[model samples]
Target: MGVPATVSSTSSTLPWNVHRLPRADGSVFLVTGGNAGIGYFVAEQLSATGATVVLGSRNPAKAENATASIRARIAGARVRTVRLDLADLSSLQSVVESLEVECLDAVVHNAGVALDDPPRSETPDGYELMFGTNHLGHFALTWWLMPLLSAAPAARVVTVGSFAAKSERLDLDDLQSRKGYQPKRTYGRSKLAQMHFGIELDRRLRAVGSTVASVVVHPGGALDSLTPSRPPIHVPTTGARLSAAPAALLVQGKHAGAWPAVRAVLDPAVLGGQLWGPRVFGLRGEPRREPVWNHLADTSVAARLWDASCDLTGVDPGAIPG
Candidate 1:
């Protein structure tokens, strides 16, 4: 499904309220992996702003159900779905070509894969599953979608990072995690790579004097148990909510988890290269501009990661003329 493209009147001069998004009438945004979890909520919230929301999902049925849920809650909401499989590198261009919009106001890079425990797996391109999908996939997608993004007056690319990435470091030599793979650690590193990419992308975009902004955000400790019901998608039982009540004091539900990304997308004052996360102890609270972690601030590492990503994906995000 598709909605007609329109000029965006999104302005940074407007006041911002996290609970209530700025009106984005005539804008179009894409939320990868928007079928469920935090992505779903991002789509729902964006839909309320009157922006045409495109949900990128690998499953058609789930995508339709998500769009239906959004329509059910927000009257006259405009939403569409596109088949997107980040793991399959060859198919990405086709996905971008399929989009009917002439310009894209923003894209929330929220789709990711996490492996708790496992015999390590690789994507279709033979890269580690976590690193491949979480980092490289979005990296390539951005490259292909840059044209549409540039068409907008001030486009934003919001990358959803992870709290797990805070303590992790990238091993440039073994980015694929081929040497020794601990599922938890590997997942964290992948997200770390994503953060590095977002920051590096901002640097490149600024160096080229492009209006497109890249912002990174991480949800604190979001648990599904604390999430509100969105029937046919996520419906935590009363018992589950009760069991999670104690933890709610420290953490939050996925719905709240979507806050940082939402703010990054619509907060006009938000500049490129800024990091946004929960305000309270970096765990749970209203979204606030936060400092980049020391590990994530290493420009050398970020540059190397950018080069490695380009080599692996065969796409140079910085290829745009300065």
Candidate 2:
């Protein structure tokens, strides 16, 4: 399918520069799975804005290490770790309670699970692992965080979707993939659900006259081999870097993959419900606001997914205070 036209284009005369970001002093932001990969880079870049970045991870040790790495790179960086296990829907309320901030400026739903092979697994909640951790997990988290998010002047909920979602569509009847469980196809469905959630959330927020913005972004094609070294967290060997150098012309590293999420959080012009992705063929280059995929633009499908999400997760995001 051909790419859709952007909802609105960023000015060509003065394009957004990812290297320099607007200062977000005193704001508080949360990044799920911030211990490594794209989440770690998102946390690191957000910390540069002087915002107190909370790295939400299931493992305490990994969270601490991620925070340490961020502190080492940025002086006086106010960063902390939170114990978050998105797979466990029951524990999420307590996780949100653990956050000390009175108001949350933004949250990046960057964490996810992608099982390569199967023997398909299920979360403690009994849902398929990928859908459970990626979509339902963030759905429940957002439901609980509505109050804090509403307190901010203009809060943003950034859902990091994937290009993998482009061709997939949710089977609302079998959201768990109970019938035929293909790892790759299931992973794409999970992300498609997430993208639907982001857009549906914006529609609901607008209906209620809420100021909270729901933005969706996809990191176009990121590879670990092309990623920058972050000490003990991630250190690509010389051989790995050299081998991946040629591919750099096409795909980018995890650090560069984080640009869309970061830009969605800080850019004043970015509106809720718009999709963002890489500038060059949705693969690599600077971040730019992009048009929603044809399959992803269906409101009826998104609405059905939203209703299913609320039912599965047992939280009505529509009930959140405007």
Candidate 3:
């Protein structure tokens, strides 16, 4: 996507620019893995639009750097940094402890690891690495931040999913990939789990009369998560730029790729349970609300995925802080 119609002269100076009509004046957001890639762009764009941003990363220094860069571009952009390692519950707890009094308007679950090598690995929490970091840790983080989220007049929780999700359905029997673990299956399964959590979270929040909206989204690849955890090859070495490119070309900046998700977070017309992604073949272009994805968005599967997530994360959805 090119610069927004309302872009400033300096907007062209940036590597990535987005147009979010900044009514986000008083909102607070906590974004996971925000130091780099899609997460960074999400935080920067939201902050430029007047939201206070709490950038979460495994490295607080990197988080600070990303935030500082945003401030340099958009003077006084309210942003801060906190250390969080999704794979480690201890690190997750530390972030919660650090934010003892901060409020949250949204939690952009963008932190994910994509390792497509031959072997299967487990997190410190003992789940498959892909599932553990991509889904479980985020599940734990969302539950950990429920109170801050519920306080807002209307808050949202955006789960960043992927097109690879089309291939993998929720695997309750092998949620941790105990029986078998293919990297693609592992990543897709994690994203599928996230989709369920988003829908289920919306249902549960409404059941309790809460004002929060949980929205699921498939950003549709083209973005290479630029962190130490995810290496270069995972970005799809050769291809057309713009995830919106043909299904064949899988090249796009993490920043340009974060559009659909930002829309899900800030678009007031968007329904609470609405799902969205890219309209183009490869999922890079103006965002459009999407219909429910089969199997992954299946209510039965979503319910099961929700329960399994709670079981693995040790977080009781019924007991989430509010």
Candidate 4:
């Protein structure tokens, strides 16, 4: 069944509070951008629950340090490091090949690019960098790793979306912003694509009778000022600090923002096709199964976006059943 169109309750407490989350001792999870930000907190909390976590970072040194920090905080925490750059397909392929695990319990597609006004950039593949890295990269990674996730008794693919998606509509005709590009618009579109992909992927998995589940969640306005300082990972720049100073009053801590995604990963009741996020004003409060944007429900758009992602990345979703 699809998520209810409206929620009846007004509970302030989270359904997937860290203290109440189930232990995951034997499972393995791979988290992209796990080295810092909300991703870092997600990795830490997962490891705290006894799950074996593989932290994905574009920089080997950063991954190593992040792993070390986790181990330091949680004695006997099982953590490993893998170099992953979402903007580069070759890097993703290499990481997929190097994996030795028999089953991947969950994958947190958390890495993405976000900025206010920035020069337009492109990925190594010559696609718009924001859309390419935030959406297509994750699309390809999930496609390549689906087999491993399927091997597990019950596995999940958690795609981290953004509150920014609500502010902008997707322009399917100009996904790359070829005509003209605005940084925030492109970023919002990228997140919208990710959310759309998650919903569509859920439909596909169900169609094939696949056990693997796909869920989308967002950290509500998680800002640098609200997020804890972690060197090299959560470092604040002058511009970032200036922007965050005002936002600090409105934004939730990165850790609090991460709860929705973490809950999406571990909550057994979570069904595919549900969009999860904070319950209070969709920004900060508690994790809940929120309704997705109306446009995201348009299956036609989902199918086209999925096809476009596959075409751009050259990672065929058809290769996986459903």
lDDT score for residue 104 of model 1: 90
In model 4, residue pairs whose N, Cα or C atoms come closer than 3 Å (at least 3 residues apart or on different chains), thus clashing, are none
Q: How well is each residue in 1-322 modelled by candidate 1, as lDDT tens digits? A: 0111332335445555666677788888999999999999999999998889999999999999999999999999999999999998888898777788988989999999999988999998999999999999999999989988888878888999988999899999999999878999999999999999999999899888877889999989889999989989998999998989999899998888988998888776677899999988778878999998998889999999999999999998767732
**Model 1 TM:** 0.95
Tens digits of per-residue lDDT, candidate 2, 125-237, equal 89999999999999999998899888887888999999999988889899999998899999999999999999889888988888788999999999999999998899999
Off by over 4 Å in 3: 1-20, 100-102, 224-251, 318-322
Sort the candidates on lDDT, descending order: 2, 1, 4, 3
Off by over 4 Å in 2: 1-14
Candidate 2 accuracy as lDDT: 0.89
User: Clash totals for all models, in order?
Assistant: 0, 0, 1, 0
Best by lDDT: 2
In model 4, the runs with Cα more than 4 Å from the true position are: 1-15, 229-249
Which residue pairs clash in candidate 3? 244-284
> Which wins on TM-score, candidate 2 or candidate 3?
2
lDDT agreement with native, every candidate? 0.88, 0.89, 0.72, 0.81
Q: Per-residue CA lDDT of candidate 3, range 1-322, in tens?
A: 1122222335333333246343466677788888888888788778877777888888766777787777877888988888888998646766777765556677889988988785889988788898889888888888777777766666788988888887777767888887766787888878777777778788887777776778887666554532112221123334323333454344355666777778766666556777888767646665777887766557787777777787777785535534
All candidates' TM-scores?
Answer: 0.95, 0.95, 0.84, 0.89
